[model samples]
Every structure is written in C-alpha cells, then in structure tokens.
Target: MADELVFSVEGPTATAARQISLAEAGFTERAHLQEWIIQNPQVLGEGVLIVTFEFDRWRNATGTAERDRLDVLGIDRNGTLVVAELKRGAAPDTVEMQAIKYAAMASRFSVQLLAEAHSSYLSRSGASVSADQALELLRTHTGYTVDNATFRRPRIVLVAESYPPIVTATAVWLGEMGVPVNLVRVQAYELVGTAEPTRLVSVSQLYPVPEVESFMVGPRSRGDSEQDVGPELPEIEWSESDYAKLRALPPKPTVQAILDLCSASPDTAIGLRVIEAAAGRTVFGARGELAGLTMLVKGRFKRRNWPFSVEWGATNGVNQAHYRMSAEQAERWISSAGNLEESPTSRLRSQEINDFGSPVSPAPHKESGVTPQ
Candidate 1:
C-alpha cells in the first residue's frame, strides 16, 4: 500500500514552476540588473542618465569620501542633483532618505563628478583637453566656473517595481517642504520559453509625483476639486509708499514688474533676460537687442516670489504685461487699462519711470541694488 501511494502527480504548471525558479535566481539577481541599468539607463529612469563609478575608480579619480551603493551620482539639466537608488524587489522607505543624503552631497561638491564626466565626454569625442583648456571651456559653456559653494539642491529618485507605502508618504511630505522626489517603476515579465531557455522581459517607466496625485484623486476630483481649486493664482500687494516710489520712478516699471510680465508670457521675449529687484530698479533686454530698446524696469514691487509675465506681437510690439495681484486689483487693472497692461496698480505716472531710469549713482545705472534670493 505504501509503494502504491508513492506515485508522483504532475501538473502543467510544473515545468513553468521550474522556469520561474531559474528566473528568480538568475534574472532577479541585483548585480545583473545593476550592470544593465548602468549600460542602459533608459531601462531605469529618464532625464540625464549617469552611473556611479567603481570603488577603486571613484576613489582614485576624485578622492571622494563617498561609498554609496546606488546606480548613479550626477546632476540633471535643471540643476536637480540625481541620487538614484535601485532595488530588485521594491523601493524601501529608507531609499528616499538615502537618496536625499546623496543629493545633498552632490549639491555641495558636484564639480568632482562633473570633472570626471567632462573627461569621459572628451574621451568619447576623441578630443584632448588640457587643464587650462578645460577650465576655459567650462566657463564658456556653463556661464560660470565650477564652484562647490553655490551648490544646487539635489532630488531623490527611487527605481523599483513598486514603492513601499512608507516611501510614498515620505515623498509627499518632502514635496510639501519643496524637496523634489520621484519614483520610477521597472516591470519584468516572463517571455515565452520552456525550462531549456527562458527570457525575462523588462521595461522601466517614470511616475512623477503629480501623476501619482492625479491617480490617487481619481476621476471624481477631476470634476469637483480641480475646478474648485482652479490654477494656482499668484498674488502681490504694494503699499502706498511702494506705489509712490514706483510712481516717482521713470516710466520704467520695477524689475519685478518686468519679471511679472515675462512670467505671464513664456512664449514671448519681453521677460527679464537679466534683472535685479529690491532697490526698485531692473534692466532687461527685449524687442530684440538689435532694436536698440532695452526696457529698464525699476521700483519697489511687493512679494518678490510672484512670477512676472509679458506679451509680444507685431501690433503691440512687446504687447501687454501682467503681474500677480489681488483679485480686486486684477479686476481693476483689467477694467481701467482698456488695452493690455500690468496689475497691482494699472495707472502709472511718468515720475515712476524717472525714478527707475535715473539711478542714485554717477555712473549710468550700472547695478540694480536688489539682492538675490
């Protein structure tokens, strides 16, 4: 009776089970995926892709005191430092924090990595650059020489199949604090094969936080909450003195006004190409420098954080302008101007223009006294 019960029972899934085992052992290994990510960053995330160097290579090349077990250490075009942490299973809660730390480190001393990247770029291009030549090129290309102090803030990105609940919560909290964090998901599939030769299919996709928020909010929010909230309207307020100061200045609206205008018109060229605010004066080039009219905006503009805007066309030349103002002020500006104009205070006295046009210096209004944020 015992020998008769020892007969084996096999199902169709038995062979597939064996393939799954092999795939888990071979394809799911972290090191293999890590190497793949380094070679093909498109398989992980988007933006400027890069990778961390080998321990000895990084140490000998940069003398950096870092030992990050991540995929890359670099910066994106928007000055966002990339701290990419990859995972085989899921994105852990601590991955976000670890990536933040790496970002902070990169922000402070990114030149070390930039140097290596530049060297690699030159090597790939089959061009040789001397120390002096590299320095000159960096300055010419990047607008300023590489410095460690003015370090831009870094952003954290997690690469995994799915982010743990804790990671999602932490990222949302950080976003509220103005810290940029993102998640990238990599999906793996079992391609058609038997136990003899198996194939693992994989694809990576990025999910920005905004997209996540939209998903979580669902279609219901699309009709109600979204319309209720509307676009994030900017606001600005100016005191009587601020108004008087602006009025006293030449017809030049403050640099803030120019910025405010430019912010409104991303497609136009009337915005502040170069500017400074605070002391109530701004110099910006518009209407084409060849047109020989560099509009100088100047005056005390409240709420420096509000984005400025502008409009440009053949009929209006540089066209109408706009700045963030109170709802009431916005209505007032719209009502009074009849034509397109800026907000906060629509009526401008020529005296305000003189104030911004004529500096408190002997030299030709060389510098705007407003300090940068």
Candidate 2:
C-alpha cells in the first residue's frame, strides 16, 4: 500500500487516534472509488461539471475484441469536453495516453450526442429528463451555449492516489502547449469513532500548479473561434401615435409598484427617466449605480382600451425578464393588484419573442387607427 493518511485527536494532550490505508479500507478497488466520485463529483473540485459517470461504452477503432469506457465525462463553463480518468491506486504509465485516445473519440461528440447520453444517464439514475431538457440544464448550469463550436475540443483530467513523475511532467508540458490537461490526487482517510461510517476523503490538484491552471481552463482555451455577437437592433421605428397610445393606457399596479421602487432612489430614477426617442415611442430607461445595470420598458398601445402589448425589458444586469403581455391583462391586474403571483407570461425571455417574428396574415384595414367593423 502507499503512504497511509492518519487522523489525530487533540485535547489536553494530543494523541494519534486512527490511520487509514486505502487498501485496508477497500477504497483501493477501482469500482468503490468510482462509485464515490459518481455520487459526489464536486469532490473533483469547483468548476468541474460532470454530466455523466461511466459514460457510454466505446469500441476500439481497430474493430478487434478490445473496447474502452470513459470513467467520467463532462464540460467546463466554456464547453470544452472534460474526460476524467480515475485510478484507485498508483496511476498507470499508460493512463495519460488512454485518456488522450478517449478525448479524441469524445471530441467528435456533438451537442445532441452529449444531450442524449445525459438523458440516458438520468434515466438510469431514476431521474426523468429529456435530451432537450438535459441540454438546457447543462447550459443553465455552465453558462456555455451547447453547439458545434463549443464542443469541438476536449480536455483531460487524471485522478488517482498518486501519479508517476512521467505523467506529471507530460501533463505540465501538454498544458503549457495549449492542451488542457490536469492531475488530481484523491486520498481516503479513516476516523476513529463508533460512528456507522468512519471514512474521509481529501482531493487536491497537483499538476501544472495553480497559477497556470486558470489560464489553461479559461474561455480562450476552450477553442471558441467566433466573435461575440451583440443584440440585434430593431429595424422598425416607434411612431409618435404609438407613444401617445402607450401614455394613455391605464397603468397596472404591479408595474407601478416596480416604478415606485425605482422612484424611491431619486438619482437612479432621474437617470432612468422615460425617453421619447421617436414619434409614438415612449421608452422608460434607467441606469443603476453599477455599470451595465439598466432597465428599459417599451410599449405600443392601440386605440381600444389598454396598449397592445408592454415589453418589460431585461433588468438587474441580467436578461431574465424580457416579456410582452396583452394590454387588457395588465389593466385587470393593475386595477385589483394584490399579492402578486408569478404568471407564466413573466418567464418569457427575449429569444422566445424573437421566435414569433415570422410573417403573419395582414389585417383587413391598412389605415392607421382604423378598426375592422
């Protein structure tokens, strides 16, 4: 067995209490350690997003009797595939090479393939989730868009009790050469007590040091080749008549309450005051103390009762609440606004609205402010 980790108890006088050996604790078995990691992937460290453990089996390209299985597969925040190879005892000399082969095969995996694998893993674990749902969950958690560009390359991670010097040197060289590879050492310890379970684990990253690790795993290293795409500006201008209609529409208490909250801060409210940029356009814009902190509200009213729709734009430096709702609903809620409940409409984001931009049948009358009889 390797050097065993010991636990000491300290009181008036300190004394060595219990010592844990991976071999004696049965953690030296690959299956046992694998199971523990599958249960608690966070032990791998922060920013490690494990999508599935014991990922689907893959046959060797040579078509022989040989086959290979990846112990764990995941993606970091930047969407680079992470192939984690685990060992219970000493890491084999061929572990890094085996991981490279796995990474090569996994690099071909498209976002759809990853989502399907994740869905299957979820099903096996008794948690129900569709491939689309799994993909959305992955995006929500990692903040990385799942697409071809994002999943083009892969990184490698080796986890074991100890790694040979050769493997450590190779990992460092690969990392410096722009290949994102890391080594993590995980050791098991035992606690002296009458408790039902008396084992503890410690995980530490050991290769490439800490300073270089960040740069190697950062966004630039994820192989993202495309430039950042900004939000598309609206082509149609707001008419002056449109602004008048919006101003005449009755205010909903729900919206007014939000306005009131903004009003409480005079400086902020003044900075965010409504701007009438174009005829028939009324935009309530405000900037918070924080840079890029902004709120914008745009509405288009019809001659009928309420405005046709009101768009409560993104708020709080986050694009969470971009939604459009019918004028009548706003009026009804505002007139009798009480305890507010989350409406399904409020969950709409900008993408959902953009999806509704397809051409539609034209109304009978083309004249402005004209209603069909």
Candidate 3:
C-alpha cells in the first residue's frame, strides 16, 4: 500500500487531522478505477484528448490464440494515438510489454478507422452520430487533425495506483530508447469531515521525469504498404474585398444582434446556435432552414465572385453552414456589423426562436408587422 493522505484544517493552530488510508478507498478496485477513469478522463492530466474507451478487442496476428483489450484509446495534442492501460493495484512486470503490443496494433489505425471506432463508442452512449461527425469533433477538441503525419506513430501510457520497481525500471529503459511510453500513478483519498464524504484523486506522471534527459523514439511504421491519409479538404481563403463586403453589408437587425453578442468579448467561443440563428434569418429570410441557409450563403458568396466559399459541415457537434474565412476576417465582420443600428420585428422573431431553443417554429411575419412577400 502507498502512503495515506492526511488532511488538516488550515489555521494559526494545528487542529485534529483526518487520515485517509488508501486501503479503505473503494477505488482501489480495478473495475471501479477503470470506470472512474472512463467517466473522468481529465484524471489522465492535460494534453490527453480521449476519443473513445474500450476501443476494441483484438487477437495477435500470429494466430497465437491470445486476445487483449485496450482500456482507453485517444489522441494527444500532437496528433499521436495514445494507448492507455489502467490497473488499480500494482502494475504487472509485463505491463510495459503489454502496452507495446497494444500500441503496435493501434498504430495501424487510420483516421477513418478511428472515426468509426469513435462513432461506435458514441452510439453505445445513445448519440446517433456519424463517423464524419465524430472526426470533426475530434479535430475541434484536440485542435489536431487525425490525418496528420504524427498519427502514424502511436504512444503508450500505463496508468496504475502503483508500479513495481521492475516495471518502473523497464519503463525508464524503454523511454530512454525513444519508445514513447509513459507511466501515470493515480491514487484516491477521502476527505473525512463532520459533514459529508468527499474524495480526491491525484494523477502523477512517473516515468521519463521532466527534468531528466531521455531518448524519445521516432515514429514507428505500421508495416502497411499503403497509408490511409483520408480526405484532402480544401482550405478557405478570403480576399480583402470579400472581407470588406462581409463587413460593409447593411446589417440587418438579426445579424447585428448576433454580431453584438459575438463581438462583446474577443475570447468567447461563437456558439453554433448563435451562428445558425443569425444565418437562418439574415441570409435566407426569417423562414430559412439550415439546408436553405447553406444554399443561400453559398449562392451569395458565389455571386460576389469572392475567393472564399460558404460550405456546410459539422462544427463542434452540429451540422451547419459557415464561411471559410480567417479569424481576422470573421472578427472584422462581426465588429463592423455591430456598428449598424437596426431592430426589425422579423429579426426579433428570429431571436425569440433562438432564445426559446425552437428551430421548427414558424416565422411570425404577419404579427411582427412585416408583410409577407
């Protein structure tokens, strides 16, 4: 057992201390810890982006009649696949080798394969998401595209409450040789008090100490002759005139309101609903659907002969149409549009629909004093 965590009240004088024994923590059970990690993956620490867990079960290629399961599969900020294995108690001596085998199998995964796996994971959770949607979410969350070259090599992470001396030494040696393997020790502690029970867990990286120099291995080949690079999507580029037109458009009330909200703070993430609500009314008139808005925006951009295009794609978790404009272009458009002063009743109806979270509501043009064309 590891050392127990002690908690004491912070005061001028030391009060009675509450000792939390690791042995008494229920998370010491392997299954419990696994579930906890699955539910709260941030416990793995920063930079780890969880794509899916219990990714899949596979057997060795040699027909050895042995099969294994990967506890958690994800990608890091560097776009490298991460194979994480979890154990509540002391990790076995062969844990490093086990993780290596898992990584060897996982390294062959392409962006499509990962997207499919993630889609399945989401389906099991009752989310009817497609593989493309999952891939888009992955890109948004990690800010790393799955098709990046770094994903060609996979990394291994071993997580346990404790690692035996032999396991630590082997991990150190492997890391020194550039095997991209890491060890994380996770332990739970209970904060006992007169009120209710509270538990705290700590995750610490143990191998390849930050201060120590260690050899890191280059990307490993998946032994496949053909690489699946997935789709080659085109990047959107906006011309100076396109920026000017988008900024100078006579701001309709709906568009102005959205711009005001978005431009109020430079750091706020523009929500999908805000964009959808604004685009629905401003671009396609108050009665527009997402599909219609997509066509209208695309058509408008095309008619202008702009260098950029408005394409419909999955963003965050929803499918919507957005311009392929640079951040600066988008900011300028929002800020400049905010300067316009107009508040039409049709725009108020659009805002009401957005505020009420009802996308199917009929536009109240008649009641809003706007004659239906």
Candidate 4:
C-alpha cells in the first residue's frame, strides 16, 4: 500500500498528498469505508465476494446474545464467509474477539438466510432484486446456492486505519491457531488540488503478513461440524443409528438432486467442480452438505474426525475433497433421502429447484480409478 501520493501542476509547481488519520479526514466506518469495500471488494483481497453489510441477522432466540452487527460480510473464493469488522481509526483491543464471535455466530446461518440478507442489501441499495434472483446471482458468481447448503466456516478480515498492538497480537495469535483472522491496515492520504481535496486510501495486510503460508491458500472446504478435531479415519461402516441421523438431517433438495445424478455412476468418483456445476452451486454449497453428512456418520461411528462420507471416504490431493462409493450406495442414500419426512413448515417452502429446473442430465464425471479420487 502506498504511503503518500505526489501530484504535479500544469506549471512548474508540484505538491505531495498529506498523510492523515481517517478520523482527521472525517470518514466514518459504515458510511464511507464499508461502502467503499462494498463497491470495490478487491481492496479486501483477491476474489473476496461481498454478501452484505451491517449483518445483524444471527438469531438470538434465547434473548441472551447481543445483536451486534458485522460491518462487511463476504466470501473468499473458497466460499467461507468473510466476517469483516471495520474501524475507521485505530482498532480496539477486543476487535479480534468481537470478529471471532461474529464468525462463530455466522455458522448457524443457512443458505436461505444468506440469500435473504443479500437480497435485502440489494433492494436497500436500489437494485430491487428478489431473494431468488439474489440467490441465482450469487450462485452464478461464487457458486453459492440456497439448495441444501450451509455456510462454511467464516474467515475474519479486520480493517482499520491502524490496529493497536494488543489487537494485532490477538489477531496474530488467532491466525496462528488456524482461526483464519486477518488484519488489513488502511492508510489515508489527502490529495490537495488547486480546486478541491480528494482523499485517497491504500490498504496493506497486517496479521497474515506475506509470510503466513497457511492463510495464503484460503480456508479449507470444511463445515462447522468439522471444527471438532479428531483422529483421521480412512474408512468406516456407519451403524444403523448413523442412517437414522442421516435421515433426520435437514433435507437439501438441490444437493440431493445433484447427487441423484451422480448416483447413476456411483463407482466413479466425480470431480468436485463437475458436481458443483450440476447443482448450480459452488463447491462450498454442496461440499458443506457432504461434510455435514460425513460428520454425522463420524459422530455416530466415533472415527477419526476427518470428513468421511458413509458412502465413501474423501479423495486426497485435491483442493476440495471428493468422495466415491459403489453406484449402488450413491443411489441408495439419495433415494432414501428423498423419502425422508419433511415437517409441514419445511414442505411449504418451494423445493430447491425454483430458479433452475431439474437438470436434464448430470454433468460429466470421470471414472473413479482414473481420477485422483
């Protein structure tokens, strides 16, 4: 990030932009800074997609938790929610803790809530888009979908004019602990012209400094249930109780429909991207459901806590984990899922195939032994 800017006059006179604090420039967090990020998200990081700002929708049904709002909610290319806390001036010591809390709360949000939030943001911002359109737009851009999806773990990005030493220390510690918290410092410069003044901003990463290799790749494709670390299990048989839990799991109509297509060739392991395209969702959308399925079986089977579908274990050496089972198992699981009971409330919601029709056919898939899976 640039510290200062130099400007030249048409004549011989030249001038340099003055450094200033955001407060000194009278720029506020919500009005100026958040809007800037919302308009141009590249300032946050490469491929960081915005979901909404001022997100206060985490449910507090117990009436205990505070309705604190996160400033800018977004997603990294990997589909993990980017919980950004913005401070116009220096960030306080508790900022890291605050952002972590928001990230934790965000895990409870389902695909619908995120789409609704985005739709609300678009309408309020004068786009006049409905939830379905917002869902489709999000799916098209980021591969995120409302069908049978849950948000992957959220990644934290804290932006401020400056961060106090304690704040950065905590943020660094969180990053080291694999919490995915990042600190970005914004520098303010005033470009003084003969006619008017223009404020310029430059951002430089702090916590996950250039050396932080772990964060460079973005978050792994894992769901909230995978947070509980345990030993690794290559394969395992789920108990009958495992099937019951799977049956009781929230119905993901769209993901299941996509899997129904995959069931046609169960022995072959499909690439992660192919399945994502067929579902009209990003890898994160469908993968979260798959991860949840793996976790459910793990919870019942008490295996190593790594993601493993009862149908098949995760294929290694890939950015996103892909599982394969005998075509029979694939068909059995999805076929049974379609029969799982939906409560009256859930049945009322239109099935997951609203914007997109039932795919005429499944996307292409490679043979399992042929692929890395």
Candidate 5:
C-alpha cells in the first residue's frame, strides 16, 4: 500500500522486497539474470515457474481473419505452454486483456510447436541440445512432467510495479476458475549517501497475503499429511538369543546380494564405481576393497537418517552373546572380517574377541600435500 512502489529494471526501493528478489535484482543489465537463475536454482524453490528470454515480437495469424501479432511464448517444466505479454512502465488496463488474447493463441498450439520453439531457443544460445534431448533434460532438471495426459494451463504473468484494483481482483477470481495468473512487481531502489544502489530487484506478488502462504506452505503440508503414519506396532524386541543367531550367520555380501538379485555381472568389480542413473554410465576406481565396502555401507545407512541402534555378538558352542553397539563399531567389525579368504564362521569367532564381529582395521590414510599443475 506504499506509494513508493515504483517499478523499474533495477533494485527495489524497500528492504523487504529486495530480500525476496535478491537473485532476480537486475533485469535490464542484459540477460545475465536468466543465466544466474538457471545456474543457482537453490535460491528459489521447486514451485518456481521459469520464463526465459523475453523479447517483443509479433506474428501474423492465419486463415479468414486478419493476421495478428503474438506476444510471448514460454515452456514450463512439464513443457506446459505459457503465452504471456510483459507490460513495463505505465500501461493501460487493456494490457491484461491483450495477454489473455496471447494465451488464447498459445492454447491452439500443438505440443510439437512448443517443442520446436524450445529447441530453437536452446540452439540459438549454442547449447548442445536436440528437441527430444531438451525436453528430457528439462523434464529431469525442472521436475515437471510433460505428458499428453497432464492438464495444460494458460499463464498470465503481469510484470509491473502495481496493478489496477480491478486487474488484481480479476486475476484472483480467474485463478479460482483454474487459470494460472501471476502478477509480478518489478521495483527499483537507489542507495542514498554511501549505500551501494546499483542493484535491480523484482518483488513477485507482493500483495495477496493468503495466496503467498498457500503457495509456499500448502504443498508441503499436504505431502506430509498424505505420508504413511509409519508402523502402527512397536519395534521388535530382541534378546541375547537373537544376537547369537546373527553372529552365527556371519557377514554376508550386502552389495553382492543386490547385484546377484539384479542379475548384474559378477565381473563388475568391487572397487568404487560412480553410477549415473540417467546416463547409465559408471566411473570405476581402485582402492582397498575393505575400505570401499565400508564406505558403501555407511553411505546407504546415512540416507535413512533414522533414530535407532544396532549391535552384534559372537556365537560359540551353546553360548550366545549380544550387546548394543553404535553404527561405527558395527561397520568396523564387518571391514576386518570381510577378506578374500576369510570365512564367515572364522570371522564371527575372531570378531567376538576383536569386538562385535565388525570388519577389520583399515590401513592408515596419509594426507596428500601435492598440488596439481
């Protein structure tokens, strides 16, 4: 409600607005803003609708009607079609209507048409991406699905400092009708008297408090609610007998079990291999087998981030001992016992004296002080 809301292709005049759009500060300083966004996406959350490379262009319409100019066309993460018209400076209320007209044009377009446009944009920018490749990459990077079954919605993003009250009210009302509308306010700020004021900022959707909260917090709460309440029953209680059963079983191949189940080749080697899921490529490296196996176990367990404890014991003639041990201690036992020739039975007994049947002591690692040229 402040009259200080002056839109510009520069920094915001208010501190609150600046923090919201800190990353999107400069708009007129060439097209660096778009590049900054694509690179450092952590600045914004996944819900962001990215519109890249906007320029004023007009295209003639086809058929019996007179030809008309199309305003803006953008592709969303799911490759959803977005047709928008940007209005800068003091524009007429009619600008919103014109944006709707552009959206209508975009709605008539086939997915192939949008795909071609995406490909062209990437190509002109010298990016090595084919049409299919671009779509695939965008799908993964943006977490937006672009299938025929997905509902396509038209978007109208009004980039201005302020909108008329009617426009604001209309956008909200249309939003209820399934139309996606975003009124982004671009404002300018100058640091006076020793304040560095060369920055440009954009405060997107400053007004409409409830809508902002719904956009940020609503999705997360819904997801949390839908999540399983977790096991209704309490955890299993193990006694000394249970510990003896595991100790007697011996350390079996965890990773190898997965590989065998998946029918993966046994010759795949046991060293470190960085497997890329999308590319289906694995980079291999060699180190002590014991160390690599231990790291793999630690990495998998860390992902759980669960709150629980596990312990190990030794199985001897008629006597079974089990005690609680920390995660670190269990891993150490496995490393020591898992060797080329060591059998599970021998390792189990050795570990009882060595500690809860962990692997083995790893070789000491030295810090490499050498620098590469």
Candidate 6:
C-alpha cells in the first residue's frame, strides 16, 4: 500500500509529514489501538456501545473455555452486536476468517449475557455500572431491544492500516451474501510543530464508500439483516416519553440551539455555520463525533434515531455537510426541549431532499453564504 500524507500548516506554508509504521511510531495493537477505539467507538459506527474487549467468556458444550479473545465488541443503534478486530499495521491474510469466527461466537450471546459482560467491563474501567443499569443503558442508547429477531447475528468490522486483496474480496463476498462487514483503516501520522505530542490518528471507512452512495432507492420493509438499509429512513417520531427522556438529559446548550434553528424554518436543512452562529461556538466534533450527533446521539441516556439528517454537497467550491430536521420533528423537538424563539432560519424549502446536487428551492437562501463547516 502507498503511504498516506498528512500536511501541517504554518501561516501560509504547508509541510507534508511522512507516514510511519505502527512499530516505528511506538504503537501496539492491544495497548494503543484497542484503547482508542474503546474510548471512541464512533470510528466503527455511530452510537456503538463498547460491551467488552479481550472477550473470552465463550464456552464449548463440555464447558471448556474457548480461549479466543476478540479485540473489541460493541453494539450499534440497531442492537446488532459489532465484532471489531483491530490491527496496528496491515492485516494478515487470515484476518477475515478469524473475524468471522469471533462474530459467530458473539452471535450466540443473549441480552442477559451481553449486559453482564458490559456491566463487568464498566466495573473494570472504574465506572461500576450494574447489569440492570447496563441493560437499561443499552435500551436507551440503541432504542431497539437486543432480544429482537433482528440482532440474531453480530456484524463484523476490520480496523487496520491496510488489508490484503483476499481479505477485501472476502469482505465484499460476505456483504453480497447478506453479512454486515465494514473495513476501516486507522492511520497514524506525526505532524511538525503541533504540540508536545504531534501525532494525529485518523479513521476512515474503506469498503462501502458512503460519500459515493449519496442516495439509493431500495426496499422499505425492515429486514432481519443489518445490511438492509432502505432508500431513506423515516423520521423518528418522538413520544411524550421520548421528550421526557430528552428533558432528563444534562444541559446541552449546543443541541438546544440546533433544535431552535431547525425548528425556525421547519422542514428545511440548515447550514453548519448558521447552526454554529446560533450556538455562538463550534458545536460538533470531527467527522466521527459529528456522526454521533447527526446520525445517532450517544452519551448518558443518549437518544437514538435523532430526527436530524446530514447531507453532503458543494458550496462555493468547498464540500460541506449540512443537517436538517423535518417539520414534524422540528415542532416536536422545540416544544419538548423548551421554547427558544430566534430569527427565522434563512433556508430554502427544497422539494427534492434526495437530489441534493440540484438547486435547493425556488426561494433564495439568506443563510447559504454563511460558510458551512
């Protein structure tokens, strides 16, 4: 694989930093890589909860320990168990088969078993989360029951610097055969004149390129497979109970501002700069952090299926992703989250949200020139 480049900007000058191997950079699979993923699991998927790492609780029919430890195990917003295998460098050829075995073993876990493991993991991390509490946390974060028929199988995610051709081929074949597999590349780069530690770690999805597949016309029926993504997901309706849950959350000033801005124009997608200006600060984190916000909200009592949808497009030659809230949810969110009356959001009411590349609407957008993030 060709080495990737990371540039450092000093004033108007840009310096390209050479990409180094994991060993050269003093990183190991278990210590550095696994810990980063556990701390921030959005690298794999939005709203994925870390159940446990180095998991080897599986037992054979004879009650013998299987003695196999998966690197990291998590669950996404849809309650599908995520089996993520980590590698600091390029993955060996046998990695795919190894991940498949770990996934198969994890698929046998029930809601009870999964909660117990999560609780244990939490305790080890000095967080002391009980099994019952863990189960409730799972329900609130995912908004889907783990015991449902949909979570019968676990999904697979491979994280490495690079992968062999055979491994990528197997991943594609598995996806075609209805297996949910994601291949991610985690890059490590050292920048010049940054801080005490000038290292920069970036995670990106290699397979199933999302930026290319902006929209897909597909079936709407809910399927058992996690890979069955419909053309467009319906806006999640928030109930009184859901509103109460939102109110229970700690003061999220940024989220509150977003609700007010989107609620102002109802059914219109707003620019990130306008949202940021409304909030009076840079609200969302990097791409992974932004995914946790727009795609799925995750934290203590984080709400799943947030009514926000982010669409990527070009603005003045720069590509930016914008967030939108439907009219129904906009009204619901503002009322539930407390009323905040601001200036009307400057947005065009587009007829075609699916065809984002086309001109937004007949009406001009006052906020379009606000410079999206």
Who wins the lDDT comparison?
A: 6
lDDT of 5 by residue, 1-373 (tens): 7644534334554333332233344443224433544443322322344333443232333222324444344555444655544444433677678777666555554333344455666776777545444443433333324433232456666556457877878777778777877666655554333346655454455333453544453234555533233322223333334333433443334322222211122222111111111112221111122223333333432221111121122233111112233434334334433444433222222222322221121222221221000
TM-score-sorted candidate list, best first: 6, 4, 3, 2, 5, 1
Name model 1 segments beyond 4 Å from true.
Answer: 1-25, 28-31, 43-46, 51-66, 110-113, 117-151, 193-198, 204-206, 209-373
Compared with the true structure, model 1 gives a TM-score of 0.42
lDDT tens digits by residue: candidate 1, 1-373: 3111111125644322122332364655356666666667554344344423321122313343344444565443223446667677666678787777556545544444455454554555467643333422332232222344334666676777667788888887887898877776655544344455434444434445345454454345444633234332223453334434543445434443443433333333431222223223332222122111111121123232222223222112221122234444333323433444455422333223222221111111111221100
Clashes of 1: 29
Which runs in model 5 stand beyond 4 Å of their true positions? 1-72, 76-79, 141-144, 148-151, 195-197, 211-373
Residue 221, candidate 2: how far off, in angstroms?
28
lDDT score, candidate 5: 0.39
lDDT of candidate 3 over 53-98, digit per residue (tens): 7654443444333346678887764467888888766789888888
lDDT (C-alpha, whole model) for all candidates: 0.42, 0.52, 0.56, 0.60, 0.39, 0.66
**Candidate 4 per-residue C-alpha lDDT over 1-373 given as tens digits, one digit per residue, 9 for 90 to 100:** 6544645445787777778898888888888988888998876777777888887644354434455777888865445677888888888888888887777777656555666788898888888766555654554444332232335467888888888888878877777787887788888878766577787777878767665663454555556345344334335453344444555667664345444444544555544444555555654456456545445544665553222232211233222324345655654554555565532322222222123322121132222111110
**Could you tell which candidate, 3 or 5, scores higher by TM-score?**
3
lDDT of 3 at 322: 31
TM-scores for all predictions: 0.42, 0.54, 0.55, 0.55, 0.45, 0.59
| Sliding window of 10 residues with minimal summed lDDT for model 3 | 364-373
The RMSD of every model to the true structure, in order and in angstroms, is 14.5, 16.9, 15.9, 15.3, 17.9, 18.5
Clashing pairs for predicted structure model 2, backbone only: 239-279, 239-280, 240-279, 240-280, 243-280, 253-334, 272-285, 272-286
Higher-scoring candidate on TM-score, 5 or 6: 6
Q: Report the Cα lDDT for candidate 1.
A: 0.42
Per-residue lDDT tens digits for candidate 2, residues 104-220, read 767766665676778788888898777655654554444323445556567788988888988988898888888888798877666665466577777777875756554553345
The reply for model 3, stretches above 4 Å from the true place, is 1-5, 8-23, 28-31, 59-66, 191-199, 212-373
Cα shift from native, residue 215, model 1 (Å): 11
